[model samples]
Target: MSARVSDATSRLKSRRDDRRRHRIVGGLVAALIVVVLAAGVYVVAFSPVLSTRQIQVSGLKVLAKNDVVATSGIVLGTPLARVDITAAADRLAAVPAVADVTVVRSWPNAVSIAIVERRARLAIATDNGYLLADATGVVFQTVSDRPGGLVLVDAPTNDQQLLVDVGTVYSALSPDTAARVDRVVASTRDAIELRLKDGDRVIWGSAEQSGLKSQVLDNLLAKSGTVFDVSAPGFPTYR
Candidate 1:
């Protein structure tokens, strides 16, 4: 009986020791996993390997690269994961010449900037200088001297609809016809006129039927007339 009791006690002690060993091993593995994760996080978030080292620009025409870089305010050596892409793009969009901009982090050491620049479509004379407008009638740049190849506009800059109408008419002109145009004048949305490089005038009437008006003017230009009226294109008259 004494031998049986001692054997039973020994078995119980062995089972307890086994459980303690398992607990210790499990804790050590958990600690090791935590350390590994912390090291990986540090490497990715603070390491120089993924930091910005170069800048790549695309879709640039009028804006200089240096000017764009300065406007972006994205610093070199910043960790890729830490860059505020939205803020950088907002700053770039503030530039008058930029119509649309996209900023992104090209992983493993580069920042990419893609921008769409506004094309000069019309020139509006301002008190300070000339305001360059795009095809959508949004003024983008102010220049001291008049830019060539753009028709000067004499209209109320504050009248958005009038400016839009004028732009519509100007955009409808063919390259050959556009060259013959000197300036556009509008008192209201319904009263838009085109003055040719010569002393002739064209009553454009409104922004409606611009394509038909342009076609009629092409045919009328050959006739002997000082004034062309394509306002009613179906029954056009020139005198």
Candidate 2:
């Protein structure tokens, strides 16, 4: 009986040792798994595997691609996650011709930059050259000669708002009437005039009611008149 009891006690001790060994082995495996997962996270976050490889630019007209890319300051091999899209876009927008810009990260290691340049609506005469103005009255490009198919703006001062008003009025005219416009003069905000290519003058007051004024002027042009006053389109007068 003593020997049998001794044998049973030995078996129980062996079983306890086996359980401890199993627990140690399981703990080691869990630690290894945690270490492997941490390594993976570090590799994904900081490794060059996700760095920028190329930059693509679109919607370019007057601005050169190289200039725009340089201005954007987006470097190759930069981590895709680290690129600041808003800051890049703001830098590109500083270009005088760029009206709107969007910067984004293209998946799989590339950056895409899209630009919308301002359209030249009218030309303002300057002492050095002609300044090309956009629909928003922003003077963007300057050229030595006036561009064709664009009306000239003659404002008393370099008033951007006045030029905006002129642009608004010109945009309201019909295509045919717009093509006939030779020059726009604005001595004051409320005293805007349009000189037609056919040696006719249109007294178009402020930018208000421009659409109605344009329609009235179109009808009045059918009559024989040198000066057409549509300042108050409700009561048009011509001579």
Candidate 3:
């Protein structure tokens, strides 16, 4: 009787395993059918029967619209589904001066690309060519064109902040005082000196108290004649 019970348990286990195998096979068949249907739909939707259409590009600065489209190797009437966005972005990024590139789908048969360009800060004159320096003072380009309106930076070689300090001092000056100013020079400790159009020197000590200084200069410039110096605020003395 005991042996008969053991045999019965083994048969039940075998039946359950068979049921699981059958279910798994049915699931695989269903997945295969779905995949086949999806592939068929894709072939119908984007097949050669569909005409390749226009490539749309936007947000481009450094790259010309045509160049971006051409780099994608995608021609008009080329199936949109065939264009690889990742590959297109990589190609556009290869173009010099293009800082960044983005590719996106525009549906049915259109593609869109976006490009960013490097920024130009100030261009200064050099012996042979004008050097273009970005905000961080790193020169990245040299060109033959005469770059204008950028003040030539002349400061002690040890001083690191002349360019930025002078620009700040100019910003703080009142219109009247600024108009009277001819050139601005940065000092060793970073206070800027503004050379007046009339050959007087205005010592703008540190950039800390500029609003006060502008008010004082506005009051003083009205009574100008052989002004000695206006360095420290309250004790401004002139001949």
Q: Backbone collision count in every prediction?
A: 0, 0, 3
lDDT of 2 by residue, 1-239 (tens): 99999999999999999999999999999999999999876655567888888999999989899999899999888888787888999999998899999999997699999999999988898887798988656778999999887779898436878878888898898989888889998888899999988899999999999988988988999998899999999999999
Q: How would you encode candidate 3's per-residue C-alpha lDDT over 1-239 as one tens digit per residue?
A: 99999999999999999999999999999999999999876774667654357677777654577767788777777666677789888887776456667887677667777777655444445566665544333444567874554434334433435544544556667766666765555645445676677888777676656677777777776675655345676766555
Note the Cα lDDT for every prediction shown: 0.89, 0.89, 0.64
Candidate 2 regions with alpha-carbon error over 4 angstroms: 1-45
Q: Which is superior by TM-score, 1 or 2?
A: 2
User: Quick one: ranking by lDDT, best first?
Assistant: 1, 2, 3
Candidate 3 pairs with clashing backbones: 52-77, 52-78, 53-77
Candidate 1 per-residue C-alpha lDDT over 142-178 given as tens digits, one digit per residue, 9 for 90 to 100: 8998888888999987887888888899888877888
Per-candidate Cα RMSD to the true structure, in Å, reads 4.3, 4.2, 8.5
**Candidate 2, poorest ten consecutive residues by summed lDDT:** 39-48
Please state the error at residue 60 of candidate 2 in Å.
1.3
